[model samples]
Target: MENSSPLVLMLLGAALMLCLHPLQAQIDGTGLFHDYYAKSCPKAEEIIKSIVEKAVKKEARMAASLLRMHFHDCFVKGCDASILLDDTSNFTGEKTANPNRNSVRGFDVVDNIKAALEKACPGVVSCADIVTVAARDSVVLSGGPSWIVPLGRRDSRGASLQGANQNIPAPNSTHQTLETKFKLKGLDVVDLVVLSGGHTIGLSRCTSFKQRLYNLTGNGKPDPTVDQGYLKQLTTLCPQTGTDDNQTTPLDLVSPTKFDTHYFKNLESGKGLLITDEILYSTKGSKTAALVKFYASHSQAFFQQFAKSMIKMGNITPLIKPSGEIRKNCRKMN
Candidate 1:
């Protein structure tokens, strides 16, 4: 009986391992986890959150900028921090990409977070992970839904200026173009609608959407879909010919600082600041239109899906162990 007891215990242990394998595989498939830095740098998330909170407190708009960094980085090279690389004599980076030039602020805030992390656990956390975590913290600070951001992403040694320009959807992109771009990244239309909710707290420059105010379709008239009152307001903010091209407007006029469904609501009212934004609801026969209406009314559903879509966006083609290095300085490869 004693000899048989050992075998019985061994069989039970094997069964347990088999049962847990799928769950473990699911978590490890992307080579990322909720507590990736728990052992190596226990205070990784704490340090990041604190720095982000400080920056956001100092400038509320910084929250949206930080979140935008993660999206821009992920879309170009799968959340590898390629967007952080500065231009060098021998190599050009993505900073000057059309989608990024004069836009995408918050580099200083990221530098602050990275500097603190290095002091706490030198060479432990990756810049890519810092951007990702800061994005989540940004959302939380902005009164948006929070989720466990899977960490362990590594920084790419190089940046792709071309990819940055091509992959990141332009503000004037058509609904089909936007849908195709997201789909190419393994995201669907729902992800498209939910992820666009990030605009809930950001601002857009006049140059991005001025065409709609002047000549949306080669005609010297504003986009007809634009609410006439909103169009008048936009023209005043962004004149037909002036230096206001660099001037800015909140993406969501209603509660621009808050991360909520106000962006979707704005779309319904034809007040969406960008053509890409309005097209989500205004595009004829677009599935995104229905989603816009649904999210506008159901704030909780929008919040939940926004969180999920963010996670999905963060999971894009990450570089794991033996793939990339942990960049010491986010702007330059280590």
Candidate 2:
């Protein structure tokens, strides 16, 4: 056993490296390229943009829904458009998952975009790629920073009901739980804080935050961490008990429709709507809290980091050519 110690240590280190390699690959953005569809579908992006713009113009919240759809799709089984699949006799879709259910909307918008793309290029653009581009466009359309979206991702044949429930962080998740979920997806503290900026534009339902306002610890008292004034407002918007579970309140009360740094500012002022959103700032002396403070003061830094993080999130194990097919319809496998 004298010399076996060194050999054992080396083997353990090698195994650790092997485990980390796949996570590194998830954020590498290697096979994706900026001009992937330049020749294959010269009008692919333009077609998606026109359709998304039209839909968002008609209803501004559609922009946030599309952005969230891409996030939901990427977190589960990679950015393969698996969230778009509907439930069939043989398959159970992610739409009814715990985190999604009534929360994730904008499938109709995705369907409309898919229809126009099939006509313009005919199987040249993948549904996965279309949603990814639409998400970026949504950010820009909502007055957020812009970045060159990488293309060439294909669709997943199967949607992951379990993956959708587990991978995506919940509004009530603890600080550590939120960190772990992001880490599982190859994200860091910065990514958690920045990508959470997506909440800057979206709405959360009453059921999602009732625990905080009504019975935080089963003591029939609201969460003390939440600002009292803001808590009062939320109480009015979300009753302690009602069938208004579907009622929505903006995640960011300030500049709710605009994708900006106000989300961080809200957390700083204790106006964040979701427990998960406010936890980034309220966790006390953590890196997540520090990043929240930084973003609150420096909007430019938040935008730059946000663009980089979005690209990283988009690179999550995409199904490139020959692995996943380009679905003729985004809602059903073909």
Candidate 3:
């Protein structure tokens, strides 16, 4: 009741929430599993980033793989631990885009972790766990989702390319559309706003967002009030020329590779990198805007909500108990 002590009520509510969602019961490893997963994620991310760092260094095409994996999985059936597979079973490409995002070479760093874990723990850890840990670490490493959840979410043995395509929102989707999609995943409108914080890293091809500068007019373009100089920069980077330029911008312009409040500020300042990013502040997503306000005002609040959302998102139809096997290789059926 509103009349009850807020602190006592808060404890009661959290206890109820944990009871209703028994995933917390899975964290009985004295935090060792949590620590192991957290510690290993950086190592995996260093490898993934080292690969991307080369692209930054050589001005080469950045591998869209690691980020691609997260988007593909989360969008499909609410991050259902399926994208960690390289085989074709349990899912179909027509339903998800897992295959398309499966750029083997880019995930070599994660592969390194699997191999190391294989030696250190030998089949104790799953590729699903790898992707889950990698997703969080990837966020921290490249600048997004700051907390780490448990790593015992076992790897599944099926990869569904169609699943990715069906679930992942097209870069140009409207804020209203994205909210519905996230809602279907058991996440609220605010979850989509926060989950998309993944955009803080990675690059989107011109084809994905070019509709703004070259086509859309007036408010159809993101932040219609956004500076013309900035618009011109994206056009130049993307090039309307015969060839496509992969001109990518950091979603969080301030600390492109660090997870922070810059994303919320960007939305308020009209500097969100993608059309979808900016739309959350628009009419269709005023609630999302409210969340941005909360996140900006209370850092701890945002982190806590973000962590819970990650857990909810990760638990979608998980390969619970003995439901699936951990694949030996993430690229193909073993």
> In terms of TM-score, which candidate is strongest?
1
Error of 1 at 303 (Å): 0.7
Give RMSD to native, each candidate.
3.2, 9.3, 7.5
Cα TM-score of candidate 2: 0.91
* Candidate 3 weakest ten by summed lDDT: 28-37
Per-residue CA lDDT of model 3 for 178-246, tens digit only, reads 887787777787678777765545555666667777666545444474447767777778766676445
- What's the TM for model 1? 0.93
Models ranked on TM-score: 1, 2, 3
Q: lDDT tens string, model 1, 108-137?
A: 988888899999999989999999999999
Q: Which ten residues in a row have the lowest lDDT in candidate 1?
A: 20-29
Clashes of each: 1, 0, 14
Question: Candidate 2: deviation at residue 248, Å?
Answer: 0.9
Off by over 4 Å in 3: 1-68, 77-81, 87-106, 142-148, 217-225
Model 2 Cα lDDT, one tens digit per residue, 1-334: 4567988989988998777654554456556776777787888889899999999999999999999999999999999999999998889999999989978899999999999989988887899998999999999999999998877788999998999999998889999998999999899989999999999997888999989998888898888888999999988888776568888889899988899989999999889888888889999889999999899999999999999999999998889867899999999989
Clashes of 1: 1
Better of 1 and 3 by TM-score: 1
